[model samples]
Target: AREAGAPAAELAEITEATAVALRIRRTLGQHRVREAQLTALFDTASDLAALRDLDAVLRAIVHRAKLLLGTDVTYLSLNDDAAGDTYMRVTDGSVAEAFQRVRLGMGEGLGGLVAQTARPYATGDYAADTRFHHTTTIDSAVLDEGLRAILGVPLRLGSRIIGVLYAADRAPREFTAGEVALLSSLADHAAIAIDGARLLEETRAALVDLNAASETIRTHSEAMRRAEEAHDQLTDLVLRGGGADDVAAALADILDGGILIHDADGAELARARTGPQPPPTPAVAASR
Candidate 1:
């Protein structure tokens, strides 16, 4: 204390200790704030997993990323390479047209790198980075595609990278370690929901094919049943003391009867006289 005439060295030591304490307090406060924010984000993303529609889920993902990261630009890219070429699907923020439908070879570009490596990447200035190509934006005529700082996280389902989720800021900004971790967690949930939606769509298509097959089988069974009935009726006629002449007479009468025979193809294949009057037109027989 001043009144106690403390040594200058001792005073300096006390000042240094106070400064360290203050720094620790500030750091601890920041940690608590980040923790709270991450908890809320995690809960929100967990709720979002209930969404089953792919487009709706993607929109929610971008919206949540914007909210959680406090960035104006958010984007998601899914790799659609049936032929081993990477293409961009969608983005939350404005992108240049040149980038649209542009395919990149695996590991040839930044997005490609994310897909190939299945890792997260960040850059302070995309234009300055030799690893990224800014000319693509220029070619696309997307003037609003300015990125001072960007974060790209690979979206993985199990060990495979399905796509990538990204956020960008026009003004340079530093993302906390916690924010990166939170984004990673969100990407995991997003991948699961996306994959589930894809599987559901596949299952629905399979069910449709199965239904068509079942209908075809039912139609064939009905045709067989009709043929069996006809055979039994024909046998009964022969057993009832009908000789060839009698059979011919009976067939001629039945043929003269005005009746229609239908086949599985919805065609009126044959006609007979089931009524008292015979058909004025001659009877015609058809085979399946």
Candidate 2:
């Protein structure tokens, strides 16, 4: 157009049109990315709603995080209140054994800081980052795993921080604000699923205990009822001037077993048997 001596106004209009076209293309690309993210999140919520196993839900969360951010690795750590620390619970795209088993004390590393403060933290170079309290154990594991850049967000349930969700890379790279928010959103879903599953298990155990207690109470009630009936029958027998043999017979019938009566002088007065009877020893005979 320039060589053909096109007017300056026409050239400017063409340049403006090209710029508009580029902007529209960029906007469409962004919309596509947002749509994909929304779809992934919707699927995550669906998975959580149909949750059956806690471990499977956790694994899915980590895997989704890794895919969403296109990172080298993603993992989750859960706080152990009794142990006073956070330990790795699940991982995706991770291979190092030391890294998989690493445990971090409160405020010890990026994950620890996120757990302790209940906030998100990211570092482009974890080794050189001085914003966190570094420990030999945590640093060594990170080094072994070859993770340089790391981002961590708290898994929060109300005001409590139950764990940390992390995305890490082997090479130094700065994480963007959008990425932080995305990971934080995922952490929120993960936290609710974890807490819900735990509560469900606790409820199931309580119901089992309640059933056992009810059964025990029912058995005890039956025993007491039988004892009361037996006592009333025996009392009526004695009141009616029933002889020792009659009393023994009544006891044998009520108890569905044998009965023996002896006087204080160790002499057998009467005996009844439902089946066989062994002769009483001299010690048993003198028991009266």
Please name the candidate that would achieve the greatest TM-score relative to the true structure: 2
Superposed by TM-score, candidate 1 places the C-alpha of residue 272 at a distance from the truth, in angstroms, of 5.8
The residue-by-residue lDDT of candidate 2 on 1-288, one tens digit each, is 988999999999999999999999999998898889878888887888688678888888999899899999999999999998999999998889999999999999999888889989999999999999999999999999999999999999999999999999999999999889889999999899989888888898899999999999999999999999989998998999989889889889988988987778767778788444566788876675
- Which residue runs of candidate 1 sit more than 4 Å off their true CA positions? 1-21, 95-102, 133-144, 241-257, 260-288
Q: Kindly list the per-residue Cα lDDT of model 1 for residues 100-143, writing each as its tens digit.
A: 45565667556667888998877766656687654553323323
Whole-model Cα lDDT of every candidate shown, in order: 0.72, 0.92
User: RMSD per prediction, one decimal?
Assistant: 6.5, 2.8
Off by over 4 Å in 2: 2-9, 260-266, 274-288
Q: Looking at model 1, which ten-residue stretch has the lowest summed lDDT?
A: 279-288
Error of 2 at 43 (Å): 2.0
TM-scores, each model vs. reference: 0.73, 0.85
By summed lDDT, the worst window of 10 consecutive residues in model 2 runs over: 271-280
lDDT of 1 at 174: 68
